[model samples]
Target: MERQKRTTIYDIALKLNLAASSVSRALSNSSKINAETKALVLKTAVEMNYQHNAMASNLRKGSNPTIGVVVPRINQDYFSNVIAGIEEVTYSRGYSLIICQSNEQHAREVDCVNALVNQHVSCVIISIAAETGTYGHLQQVLDRQIGLIQFDRVVDELDTFKVINNNETASLEAVSHLIEQGYRRIALLEGPQQLDIFRQRKAGYLAALRQHNIPVLEELMYENAWTKELGAVATAKLLDLENPPDAIFASTSDFSALGVLEVAANKGIQIPKELGICGYSNEPFTELTSPSITTIDQYSFKMGKTIAELYFEQTEGKAQIKPKTISIKPKLIVRKSTRRK
Candidate 1:
C-alpha cells in the first residue's frame, strides 16, 4: 500500500493564502509572528494533522535535545521511579527521552548502548545490568563522545558522572539494626557479586558482623540470591541447616525478602519471633505484607531527578567537564518484620 503524504507548512500556507515562511514562523511561535496569525496556524495545523519535525529542526540547530536511558528492568519500582524522575526534568527542559531495558543481560546491555550511540542522543544514562562483566561497552559510549551518566549499579573504574547510593553503609545499618534487635545469627541473601552495588552491600554486612564481634559465618551468607525464587530456595536451604539463622537479610531487594517471608511461613516460622527479616528497596508491597517487611528507602525519585539535573549541569556552557560522583544515602525503614525488640 502507498503511504499517505504528511501535511507540511506549504500545505497550510496554500490553504490560508499566506507565504510558507509566514506559516513556518507562526508554527514555531516566533515573536515576529502576530498572535492572531500564530493561533490561526496552530488551529489549521491541528485540523490538517500537521506534525512538526522536531528531529529535523534539532539537527539544523546542532542539538539532539534527547536523552537515552538504559535500565536493567523497566517494571521494577526502583528503576521506574528513577525513569519517572528523569522524565519530569527532561519534559520541563523541552527534552525527549529514549528508554531501553537490558533485562539484566550483558550482551543486551551492550546492544542498547550501541543503539543509543547510533541515534546520536545528546546524553545516555544507565544502571548497568547484573550480568555485565566489563566496562568496554561503557567506554565505547565515551569514545563516541556522547555524554554518559551512570546511576545505581555502576562501574567504579569508569571516569563518568555517577549517581549512586551508599549501599555498604545502608547494608551495615540494616544488619546492625537486626543485631540490636537480638538476632545473633543473621543470614545474608546477596545479589550477583559482579555488580559493584552487591559487593558494597556484602562488605557492609561483613563490617557490621565484625563491629559486633560476630564471627563471619560463610555458610550463612548466600550468593546470587537477588530474586524472589532464589531468595526462597536459599531460605529453604538455610532453614534446613543444623544451626539455622534466627534472622535473614535479603540485601538485594524487597522481592527477595518476600520470598524469605513465604518460605518461613510455609515452615510455620513466625516472623520477628522466630525469623526476623529485612530487605532492601522499600517497594510499595513491603508495607502491605503479612508482617510489614523492614527495608531501605533509596529515595529513587529524588535520585532520578538528581541524575537529570547533573546531566544538565554538565552540559551547561557547552564545555567539557570533569567527571564526578554524587552519592545519595539510603534510609532504613523499621517495620514488624524486624521489630523483634
Candidate 2:
C-alpha cells in the first residue's frame, strides 16, 4: 500500500487562510506572533493532523537530538534485544532512535550510514555487517565530527568508542569445557574471517586445542558456516569424514548450533554421547530445545545499554574527547548438549 503523505505547514496555512511563514512561526510559538493567532494555528494544525518536523528544526539549530542505530539483521533475537536496550536508555534521556538494517550487505550498510549522516543525527551506532570490507563510509561519519560508536562487530583501528564482548576469551572457555568433557576431535563452524569477532573466536579455538596438547586439524574447521543452513551442511560434511568429530562447536551463533543439533538428530546420532554440540550467543530458543544447547551468554541487552549510555557520557556538548574501549566478558553456560556422564 502507498504511504500517506504527511500534512505540512503549507496545507495548514492554506486551510487557515494565512501564509506558510505565519503557520510556521505560530506553530513554533514565536513571540512575534500574537497569542490568539498562535493558539489558532496550533489548534488548526492539530485538527488537520499536521505534525511538526523536529528534525528539520534541530538541523537548523546545528544539532539533532536523534540517534541512528544500524544492525545486520533486526529480526534476530540478539539484535532485537540490543535495540530494545538502546531504546530503554535513549528514550529515558529524551533522545529519539532511528533504526536501520543492512541485511548483511556492505553496499547497503554504506547507504544506511550515509542517510543517517545526511539527516545530521546526534550519534550513529553500528555493528558492522559481515560483508563490510571497507571503512570509508564509517570514516565519513567521523569526518563530520558526529559521535560514532561501534558495538559487537567493529573495526579495531577506528578511533571511536567501542563496546565489544571478549570473544576470544569466551571461545577459549567454551572449547576448554568441551575438552574437559572428553570430546576429542572437535569440529568448528566459523563465520566470515573478515570480521574481527570471528577471527578472535577462531584464534580462541586454536589456542584451546594447543593448550590441551591436542593437534589442530584444518579439516575440522569449516569456513563461513555461520547460518543455520550452512551449519547443517558443514555438519553433514564433517560427519561424512573418515574420522568424524566427536563434538561440534558452532561458535558463530546458536542458530547454527541448532542446525548442528537438528542434523545430528536426523542422522540418529545420540547427543552428548555419540556427538556433542555447543553454540554461542545464548539465544532464548537454546533452553527450549530438546537436550538444551551449551552456549555463551554475551549479555546482548546489557551490551546495547552500555553502548548507548557511553554515547551520552562521552558526547555531551559534543566534547572532542579521546576514544575509549569497553569490553564485556561473556559467560559459558554448559547444558545437556555438551554435558557428558
Candidate 3:
C-alpha cells in the first residue's frame, strides 16, 4: 500500500473553494484577510491535520524561537526553580529553552556558552559557575551580539543585562540579625571570593561588623569554605581558637550552614544560647533542620522570569531598553537557629 501524502494549504484551499494565496494569507493571520476567512481557513487547516513548518516560520521572522539557558548544575534547587520560571513565560511566547549545565567548572562553562552560540539561540541566560572568575567566555557571547542575561550568581565585570539579588545587602542584614541576638564573635564561612556574589556577601559581613562597632577579626574569617566539609573544618578551627566565635555566618550557602549546625551538635553546643547560625540561599532543607536555619530568600524564580522578560524586551525591538543592572532585594528569613533566647 502507498503511504498517504502530508496535508498542505493547497488541499485545504481546494476543499474550501478558496484560492491558495487566500488560504495561506488567512492561515498566516495576515491582518489584510477578513476574520471570517481566517476562521474558515484555520478550521479547515486543523481538520486537515496540517503541521505548520516551524523552520520556515522562524526563518521568515528571522528568529530561532529558542532561548539558551546555562547553569552550573540543573539538579540544584535554586537553578532548577529559576529554569522553571523561565519556561513558564517563554513557552507561552512560542519560544523553546535549550538548557546546558556547566557542573561548576570554568572550562565547562565556556564550552556551554560556545555550544549555545553555535546553535544561534536568540538569547543566552546564565548563572556563572563558582570557579568562573575570568569572563572571556561570557564576553564572547556579548561579542557575538547574542542577548546575554545573567541571573543569581553573575559575573560583575561584564557590562550586560543582569537580574541579581542584592547579595551585599542580604549579607549585611544577616550579620546585623546575628549581632542583634548578642552574637559578638561571629565567624563567617565564605565561598570562593572570585565570584562577585560571594565577594559582595563577604563585604557585607565586614560592613555590618563595622556598623555595630565590632572589631574585624581576621582569624574568624575563612575564605573558600564553600562546601559542607569545608564548613565543618572551619567550624573545628574556629571552635579551637582561644576566642571562639559565639555565632557563625555561613555565607556560602545552606549546605555550609548545615555543617555548622551539625558540628555544633556533635560538640554539645546549644544553638542560639551557645552558638548562633545563619545561612544563605534559603534552601528547603534549611527549614527542616533541628533548629531551622536563618537564611536569605533571593526570589530565584522571579529572578529567572525577570531575566527572560528582559531578554524579550531587548530582542523584540520594544522601547529602547537600557543596559542597566536590576537588583532584586533579598529578604531575611529568621528561623530558630538565629533567634536569641
Give the least accurate 10-residue stretch of model 1, judged by summed lDDT: 313-322
Give the better candidate number (1 or 3) by TM-score: 1
lDDT by residue for model 1 (55-133), tens = 8778777789999999999999999999999999999999999999999999999999999988889999999999898
Q: Which pairs of residues collide in candidate 3?
A: none
Cα-lDDT of candidate 2: 0.93
Per-residue lDDT of model 3, residues 1-341, tens digit only: 99988898789989999898898899888998999999989988888899887756675777788899999888877788889989998998999999999999989999999998887888899988987878888888889888888887876678889898899999999999999988999999988877888889999999999999999999999988877898999999999998899999999988888889999999999998999999988889999999999998888888878888888788777577878888999899999998995
User: Could you report the Cα RMSD, in angstroms, for every candidate shown?
Assistant: 3.3, 3.0, 4.2
Question: Which pairs of residues clash in candidate 2, taking residues 3 or more apart in a chain or in different chains?
Answer: none
lDDT of each: 0.95, 0.93, 0.89
- The segments of candidate 2 whose C-alpha lies over 4 angstroms from its true place after superposition are 1-50, 317-319
TM-score of each: 0.89, 0.89, 0.84
* Top of the candidates by lDDT: 1
lDDT, candidate 2, 1-341, per-residue tens: 99989999999889889999998889877998999999999898888898778878888789888999999999988899899999999999989999999999999999999999998999999999999999999999999999999999999889899999999999999999999999989998999999999999999999999999999999999999999999999999999999999999999999999999999999999999989999999999999999999999999899989988998888674666678889999999999999996
User: What is the lDDT, from 0 to 100, of the residue 28 in candidate 1?
Assistant: 81
lDDT of 1 at 339: 97
The clash tally of candidate 3 reads 0
